[model samples]
Target: MFEPSRIKNFVFVQKIIKSELMYLQKISLANFKSYEYESYVFSERVNCVVGENGIGKTNLLDAIYFLALTKSSISNQDALSINHEAEYMMIEGSFEIGESGENITPITNNQSLITISIQRGQKKAVLRDKKAYERISEHIGKFPVVMLSPNDTDVIRDGSEERRKFFDGVMAQLDSEYLENLLQYNRLLLQRNSLLKQFSERNYVDDLLLDIYSDPLVEVAVKIHQAREQFVTQFLPLFKKHYATLSDAREEVEMIYESEVGAENFTQIFRKNRPRDLAAQRTTMGIHKDDFAFEINGFTLRKFGSQGQQKSFVIALKLAQFEMLSQQKGFPPILLLDDIFDKLDDRRIQQLITMMVDGTFSQVFITDARPERTRQLLDNLGVEVKYFEIVK
Candidate 1:
């Protein structure tokens, strides 16, 4: 027989034991972005980077984002991240993972180090404790980080590809298998498109070769579609809850996922679409064409929502992302705010500060152009904060 009180106590203890937080203790940058050579020691709770425009405040946050995601957050071109006068760039961060309490202590009292570098003509490299990773993908999710920036509005205002990328990025951090399937599906899609292009050029269609490509594509697409569907279902409630909190329960917002593979036999659909795909010289029906629609008050946010409403919508999406990642990964992720104070209203900014003070978030980095304003805003929060001032 199980005693209810005892079982509850056991579960609480287990939760505490598993609630360890991971944060960067120090970071070094060489020839990256706007900095020629710089190093920063971050506070475990909050660190603010302040500078005038073009002095590299955002670049500092992007460096931390690169360490976690193994890619540049602001640009897709890795070469562009290197300083123009330098031939290569290197970023190294030391992290601590440990149990949290009145005095947070490292479980092993040892720090883990991650180093990432890119050279002009060589493959980018990522090292864990001086050992190079065989594949960069292996480095993601080990230390999850979420970034909220002015550009987040693009998820609501931009095309479907941006929305797809946003959700795909969130899903990738939460599920390694989804990342694998996404990579494989993208590869298969390229191959299928290449074959279609070749067939169009040659004026000949081989059904057998098409079938060879189609079968594997459908297999991967089904997995990707199913994973996305499951993620959206789980993500909606969290998004709604956060939106209500941000908006004081004044508006109703919804996220709708649209995919051609849903409620249909994708295999048959792929076969049926072959003729049109050949005509278009691309694979037009798959997860690649999926979209996420943002709605407020039962209408498209892009068309109907005000600037404040849109800002709240995107912030709600990011906060929900943070919560989802924390729940899935057993600890909160490092949150990055890039000039967010300029984009969000005072009320929303206070809400974020309250989260930091209440320990809902373990580590955070914020950037601002006005140092005094940043200080004034955070002073009332009663939390320890570190500030870095960038000068040209």
Candidate 2:
């Protein structure tokens, strides 16, 4: 027999005890990027990596990103992530994941050790808890991360491919089925394009083989497109909400999902586009051809938006990404901010700091070239922050 007040208190305490806690606890880098060898133990909440320009601040953050995503965030070539004089690069991170209570000691079995290494002329290897994963894709969403960097401008400045990648990346972390379907679609598209090239070079067309390749492509393309549509439907509101918060409702931002196969039968679209694809010797339609058109006040953001507006737009997009991943994964993703303060205004920085203090974010890694500026900005926050300075 328990009093109602006591029962309420017990439930509240239990809720706090059961809250999920996930964060990177430590990282070690060997021959990775600019680091020959380095190890770091991180605070569970906020970590600030400070250094002079070219002193490897971004490299350290990239190491953490590599550990989470099993790849480099900035470089397309894995070899480029290795130190100039080194033949191999390795990054490892220890993550603590489980419940934490105020007084009770949490169980120790929640720690996950993830390791990634790449040797010259060899494929990258990824392992978790001393067990190698059969496929690296299996590790993607397990340790979710959201990165806001200077390069994020590409989402606004670049062409449709970049926008597709932005959305696809978010969907990949949230829905594994979307990733599998996307991968299959890409592989099928590659084969179909290769077949198209062969047909073009030989000046011949095989309807049977083309149809055989197109059938599976259309099937997978439908799934991928449907997933993208559903994702956008859910993602748009989040984006808008963050944009309004960041911009104070001064401007209207919109994103329209543009797909060539919209509302049309996929098989017919494939058949109709086969002749053109044969002429082009590449894929001309399908999920790969999808793009998100970003606009402000019904005009193109890329062409009409001011630089400040562009920056805010991308920030909102990332915050929305952070929100969506947090909701779907049941915990906030680790945030990596690389030289982002230099690109954003003071207001936006304050907004981010407020979120940090409010616990909207769990673990965050920030890199800055100016040590004093970084310290000055964060020193007054009164939150637990660990600062690591890089020295050449």
Candidate 3:
């Protein structure tokens, strides 16, 4: 049973987790869209960002996401959101992380200040011990984080890109090499598709086309397929276990990696589809055509599940992601819930609080339209959670 007040008690009861978050430290925003000048410093544990709709609650989290991923959470909407007077924008933050070095001892009171800034579409980040960088990537990974916003429920309702991005982004936080590989693969994919389209126009000879385009595309496609399959294999069980916990075994969930190309015999599939590919002017059979089919019992959620069931499923996927990242990287990711409580019933809300109140997450940031309703729920958990109100 997760007792809310026990969060503070849990902190006192257990040895201090140095790798766990110490605090948010401080945030400085300038000319960053709606947040012309905004600053915030967070509690060492749980800090909730509360406000009415359109008052910059989501924007605050968007700033954090931008720092972490180097991209805005709300994609195309960014250009319009940029402040009128600001040619380029910036958001800066400083924080602390546990020590890592030749010291064999545990990280007791071990921490360092980190500084990160995003300006002119470039990210300048560093983690320092008063003066020098302990490690740059260390700052990014050491403070592993995850954000679950209202928009995330679309993972169940939207295209495969959303679901794939969820996995890739989480994996990117833990594996820098994978991030590099994914970027390289995507770049090659775009070039190869362009060449293939040109080939259909009779602009390139067959041997030349095969030499320049086919082999490299297959190689990258195979690597991506294998990596995604391996990740999904390990991740699906964790997802199922979490779903069971949240839904109390009321639903059985399944995930199938559906790919039009890049199977074990993907070469044959590509060759067989070449005539059609030439007509379509693109190589359509590959990991790019893959989708994850999420099903409950025998019915597919995309076509059959009710809105409530779909939300529960997506939340379970997020919780599973949190656990997987923790297991992979040796610490739980910070959980962000933005307006998730809106349509949830009390029972489901209680279940969610049960998971978090015990400090399962190193830290959490949540937002809502009704601050008092959220505050009352937290009060029931007996936790001294912090809250902030955003004003336009």
Best by TM-score: 1
Candidate 2 per-residue lDDT, tens place, 152-229, comes to: 989999998998888888888898888888888888888999999999999999999988889998888887888888
True-vs-predicted CA distance for residue 225, candidate 3, Å: 1.4
Residue-level lDDT of model 1, residues 209-310, one tens digit each, is 988888998888888888998998999998998788777689999999898887567778778888899999999898899999899999999999999999
**Per-residue lDDT over 1-392 for candidate 3, one digit per residue giving the tens place of the 0 to 100 score:** 53454233224212333343333556777777688878888755567788889998888877776655545777744454456777556666654545322221235444444434434455444335445344444444555677777777788888998877777777777776666667767777787677777777875537565546676777777777777778888888878876776676888889888765545677877777777777777767776677888998889898988877887888778777777776666555666777778867776677668756555655667888788888777766544577889987
lDDT score at residue 40, model 3, on the 0-100 scale? 85
Task: Single out the weakest 10-residue window by summed lDDT for candidate 1.
Answer: 1-10
Colliding residue pairs in candidate 1: none
Name the candidate that leads on lDDT.
1
Assess candidate 3 and give its lDDT. 0.67
Of 1 and 2, the candidate ahead on TM-score is 1
Each candidate's number of clashing pairs is 0, 0, 5
Q: How far is 55's C-alpha from truth in model 2 (Å)?
A: 1.1
lDDT of 2: 0.84
Give the Cα error of residue 64 in candidate 2, in Å: 1.1
- Model 3 spans with C-alpha error above 4 angstroms: 1-23, 76-81, 99-142, 201-206, 260-262, 380-384
